[model samples]
Target chain A: MASHGLTYDGCNFFRQRLLLSTLSGKHVKIKNIRSRDDEPGLRDFEASFIRLLDKVTNGSRIEINQTGTTLFYQPGLLYGGSIEHDCNPQRSVGYYLEALLMLAPFMKTPLKATLRGVTNDPTDPTVDLLKSTSLPLMKKFGIDGEAFELKVVKRGMAPGGGGEVVFTCPVRKTIRPVQLTEPGKIKRIRGVAYSVRVSPQMGNRIVESARSVLNQFLPDIYIYTDHMKGVNSGKSPGFGLTLVAETLNGCFLSAEMSSTPQGQGDPVLPEDLGRNCAKLLLEEVYRGGCVDSSNQSLALLLMTLGQQDVSKVLLGPLSPYTIEFLRHIRDFFQVMFKIEVQKPLEDERKGGDKVLMTCVGVGYSNLSKTIK
Target chain B: HSERESDEEEEQGALKWKEGLQQKAAEAFLRQQAAAPNLRKLVYGSVVEAQESEEEEEELGGLFRVSRPQQSKKVQANTLDCSRFHPDTFHNWDVEEMLDSIRDCFVTGKWEEGHDAA
Candidate 1:
């Protein structure tokens, strides 16, 4: 397995394959990416993502066939530094940033990335949600310093992206093992209702409707109404809400709903979007885990690279992406997690069954980190 | 004497040992094993590793096997990689029963005996 590369089918979970390959120093080959579709082969966005990956690494070998159906990636050293990439507008900046957050801490140098593209979209976790939830989750794993930040320089919606975001992360020689079992009670629910290239009143309408739904649970609810205009607003007219439920123990579970990008889908009223987004937050609360569903794989990756000690985390039902990621982690690192279901007590009104994942880290250290 | 009488008592104790003791222990062990769902097996063992090539080779005019892409497990491996966990059935938020299900997750809800917000 060391001499031969791991081969996968399709372009799904494409980032995970490459990210794992880079961290594990294993070559990966993916074939038949959308080979049967009407417009077969890799999309322009995937090629753009590969280009971004190439920009961040050094001496990486990548090969693709003429139809772009098959790709072979021989990962190179993660030489992270200040870099910028023009993200494909098909997917949001959040899509690219998600992969970057995983690889940033293990880089040779601290990463300061300026990503430009759509900041919010319907298909992926938006930038606001990632900033509010994922960054804090990484902090719990001791990946924090003044350099850790995800600043949204501009707000952009899908289709016609003009957004910009700067993500900076400090490299860690070794990740700290965490035992995040309890989520604690949600103390306050904070949210941002943002609208760009739309009526300023749209932001207000979303806040009022969302407040009406979430005020039933807690009084400490504050939804900030942000209406960006002029050049800061992207080319599309859209409004969305990102709700973060902050627990007493600093666990952030987030839910978001983005309006349909202009001309792509049916336009949604700001009131309806807000009400539905608040309901989504309630649904997330019912799922109820220390790490939100979207960041489960990120948390698990940090745990996998921690010092050689047992790390435990309580997560809601594993997302399909996370489940596939677990299989990949086993293939790359030979680390298998002990999963256990923790059913809520009979009298407890908590939502669903939580799975506790336990794994002893492989004690992977960033050997590339220059020792001063 | 008394020592001989005690020896007789020990002999009777050995003869009247607990019946089905071994069987009882085995049943208890089996029940314990069944109670806790083996999560390790669910994660690793449930992964379908066999790449089943189910497609029958189609030969046109007795030459050249036509290779059509399969919509099998291999195809699904290439599905959308989004992390959203869309539940099959969403809870109707308008219903009071659904709202009551997650009441304890909030600080306003009931706290355990030892823990208090104050």
Candidate 2:
């Protein structure tokens, strides 16, 4: 491993830089993190993320300037085990869990994490979306076992988060390279319409309206109505819908929407939220890839780490986040992917142009996994 | 339309083979090039130029700096970190043609010759 470090500017792509740095065992320095903002520095959520990172690693060195405008991180060995974290309410637990998912398989021990905070929010990829989509995507790369699961213990909405989730992943010595050119046809559309501290009928209303949009396409549409009450419902009143379209090849693409957090702005009707979320699912199907938009980077990371084989994935047009992730992969592992666009034929009813990404993995293996 | 125009030109010429066939081929090639988006260039090449725009802060009267608070790209760098990709343009699902665009993605829709719904 090269002890020499890399540097970046701004706090943008903050998690990507840090997570990749840790995985690649490279030091990283980030400068001008909101340097010109009124309260210029790393936000509370970012600090919480750093604290979480510190807990999972051993011998890591982190430094920040007095104004918090700059950061230097020397990553340590991934020391994953049973751990608990109170994720900052500024961002949802999904934000922290995204990085943890990347680091978990390489850890010294199987990871069991109890994360407490917002479970569903409009700002990030919510917990339900990840459970339905990303975990399935990971399983394609041979990360599945009895221990692989993400369970939401309590329902929490944003702003005044009080939810809890437990995530567990079995360790892997090597990631499997995948060739996922065909995503297969979606056989069923499944979802959860959850309302917490709100009318239970809200969940039913959401399911009805969402089914109205999706039932035209497939007969196998099922949306579960979940109404959490009492202490299980978080400190706020909110409702949201997460829709996952399961394809024949076990690929999962998801879309979700949450009511405006209490006091944030104008509230949305459950029916409207349901209809919009269904439309979003249609949009995702139009994007039409083995991996959906949000999990593009995660799939790319696993591909990059796979044991020295050519990995190929068909994906939607690159998201800005995924584009930056590709650049970071190049920077950290000295790997660049062969990208090609496959346009749908003139009469084909498939959605848009797809990008085929081809890369040879770095053959990274988990030396930390202890042999029992 | 371009192909039709070329057909008209071929009819107008005494010898169609001598009528700028190479030029027409080059034009068609250039048109194809323009139509296809280069994904590799968009992902890696354009990011550098985007970051350079942030450096163009205008100074105001040697006392204060002019801040374009609404420069969305500049703000996006420091914006809330999220992985959700909001669509740039949404197709109205109410329209039949829009719905048909993705109809083949379902098991109920068309399948390739070798594959069956089974």
Candidate 3:
């Protein structure tokens, strides 16, 4: 690492740079963050994210200019323990939890996080979606145990948000390399249609409409209706649907849609929301892969940090965010994936061309974990 | 000698159509290759590092600098940082052909040999 560490411009890909810096033990300096905007600086959500990062690690050094345009972060050791955070309502809890998911496994002790804020929103993946898809994806990397769980204690929508979730994860010495090339035929499709601070019938309506679209493909489709009432429901009135397709090879592909926050845009009917969410799932199925699109970065990150061995994962067309993540991985770990495009056979009815990513792990071990 | 010359001319005309056939095929192949593109290059290559040099400010008279609107590049640099991959709008799920395209992805669809639902 250079004495001055890595330097980046702009606020785009903010979490990726900081997360990689923490893992690689490199200092990072970011400048020109919304410098030209009318209100030029970091937003509340980003500051909350920085504070959360500060809480998880010890002896970390963070500096920001008066306008918050420039930021310097020197990451400290991973000291995992119980912590609480009030995530900014501008973004959902998923925004914060995504970073914790990447960093939790390598901590010195088990991590128990209580996060309060919007649990479901349009901009980011909802906590429900991440719980269904990301947790199972992490299990494939051998980070599974009874303690590995994400629980949603309350349901919250966006805007005037009030929701809570508890996430707990066990530390790991080293991640296991995996070969997840084949995502077998999807046997069943399961989903959750949740409504908070709205009529309980909204949940049922969403479930019905979603199943109507999904029933065309498979007979074993079930969507649960969850209606949280009273204090459990967040401050906003909204509903959403999260669908996951489970394949025979234990691969999961998921998609979700949350209603527009109150006073943000035109209100959405539960029926429309459900039908559209199902269509999103079909889109995900069309981009068939061993891992879903939202979790592609997580899968790739674990592969890069796995024990020094070959890890191969078959993925659908790379998203723009994932393409950027691949470049950042190269800069951080010096690991480049061998990208190969696999064209489907003439008789095969698979959706589209698949990309096979193969790389040798850097043999990253949790140095902070105390020896038993 | 005149008849032999005529025969030679006829032979030359007959073989003229084969001219540049190899070159045409090579050009067509190159076009096809360019259409697909190399995924590795798309991911790791063509990194246009943001230039640090600021654009020269326009001076109005001898008093103040005119503030220019931020460019598209500047806007992109400071956009929201979220990881949700929005679906492409090109796919309309209502079409029957579109539905058939991924029919084999489910267990109800055609199964490959030696792979049973059991």
Candidate 4:
């Protein structure tokens, strides 16, 4: 393992660089973070993220210059007992939860995280989407039990967020290698149309329009309408839809769209939001793979950490985020994947080209896990 | 007879290029197929590496540095770090043809010979 600190420029993929550094136990230095921009420094959300990282680990050293343009982090052991965090409302809880999902399984103890902030927003994957898609994907990697769950305790929208969610995960000694090449035919589509601080009819309208678009292909589509009022509802009025297509082989492809945050942009009609979100699901299906677009990097990260065995996952075209993640994986783990493109047969109508990623895991075991 | 023989030679010479047309086309197609989808290179290519080295700064009067507005690549490096992959705008989902492209993904669509809805 290379103990020397890695250096990076700018703030893009900030979470990725830090997350990998923590997992690899290597120190990292990042500079020139929006240095040339006006009001140059780390944003509030990033500072909040760093705080969350500090809460999860023990003895981690973090230093930021006065300008917040430069940051140095030396990660400590992942001490993942129950922790509470007030995630910055600038980004959703999904932003924080994504990092937690990756870190939770390798912790010294079972993790119970109470995250508060926007649960549903346009910028990141909503808590609902992660609950529906990411948990199942993790189960395929042998990270499952009764305790492994993510529950949305409250609903919140962006701008003035007041949402809360509780996520729990059991620690694993060694991640299981998986061969997930086939994403069987989608048997059913399930969705959640949720509205907070708005008319309950908004959820129903979202469900109706979403089903109208989805019913063209499958009859087993059920969208649940959830309307939270009073204390459970967050500080803003918004509605959103999250749809998941479940394949027979236990693969899930998901898509979602949240209404524009209040006072941030043009308000969207629930009907339009539903229809557009449904179309986004179709687009996801067109890219058809064993893992949905949002969870591609997570799947790959697990593959990298699995016991020294070959893990293969068929994925759609790599997203820009996933591409950068691959580069960072190479930088931290020294793992390179064998990338193969699989063109659909001429007669098949199952969307675009697929890429099969094949790699041998580095057999990263949790040294912190206490043997029972 | 001599004139007819000369005309036959001329005809054969004129039609010579047609002899290897199919083979030439196949070779060209193979060459293209080999060059088109190098996924490994595309993912870890030099283009991404080039971004890291393009941090050239201009100085004014040997004291003040000119901070020109960032180019697209620099903007990407400093953009929000979100994981949600937005759908490609080129795919207009309202079009029937676009919807038809992914029809076979559902259970209602055509299944392979061995697999049944059961």
After superposing candidate 3, which stretches have Cα over 4 Å from the reference?
Answer: A1-4, B1-35, B46-75
User: Would you list the clashing residue pairs of candidate 3?
Assistant: none
Recovered fraction of real interface contacts per model: 0.79, 0.84, 0.89, 0.86
TM-score of each: 0.89, 0.90, 0.90, 0.90
Residue-wise lDDT of candidate 3 within A273-356, one digit each (tens)?
A: 999899988999989999989999999999999999999999988887788889889988889999999988898888988989
User: Which sections of candidate 4 miss by over 4 Å?
Assistant: B1-34, B46-73
Q: Tell me the deviation in Å of residue A194 in model 2.
A: 0.6
Model 3 chain A poorest ten-residue lDDT run: A1-10
The top-ranked prediction according to DockQ is 3
* lDDT (Cα, tens digit) per residue for candidate 1, span A51-150: 9899889989999999989999999999999999999998999889999999999989899999999999999999999999999999999999999999
| Model 2, span A1-372: residue lDDT tens | 688899987889999999999999999999889998999999999999999999889889999999999999999999999999999999999999999999999999999999999998899988898898899899999999999999999989999999999999999999999999999999999999999998899999999999999999999999999898888898889999999999998888889999999999999999999999999999989998999998999999999999999999999888878988998999999898999999999988989989899999999999999899
lDDT of 4: 0.91
Better of 1 and 2 by TM-score: 2
Best candidate according to lDDT:
4
Ranking by lDDT: 4, 2, 3, 1
| Model 2: docking quality category | medium
Clashing pairs in 1: none
**lDDT per residue as tens, model 1, B1-118:** 9998888788976856566789989988999986766656545654332322333332132455444332144547667878777777888998998898999999999999999897
For all candidates, state DockQ relative to the true structure. 0.56, 0.58, 0.64, 0.63
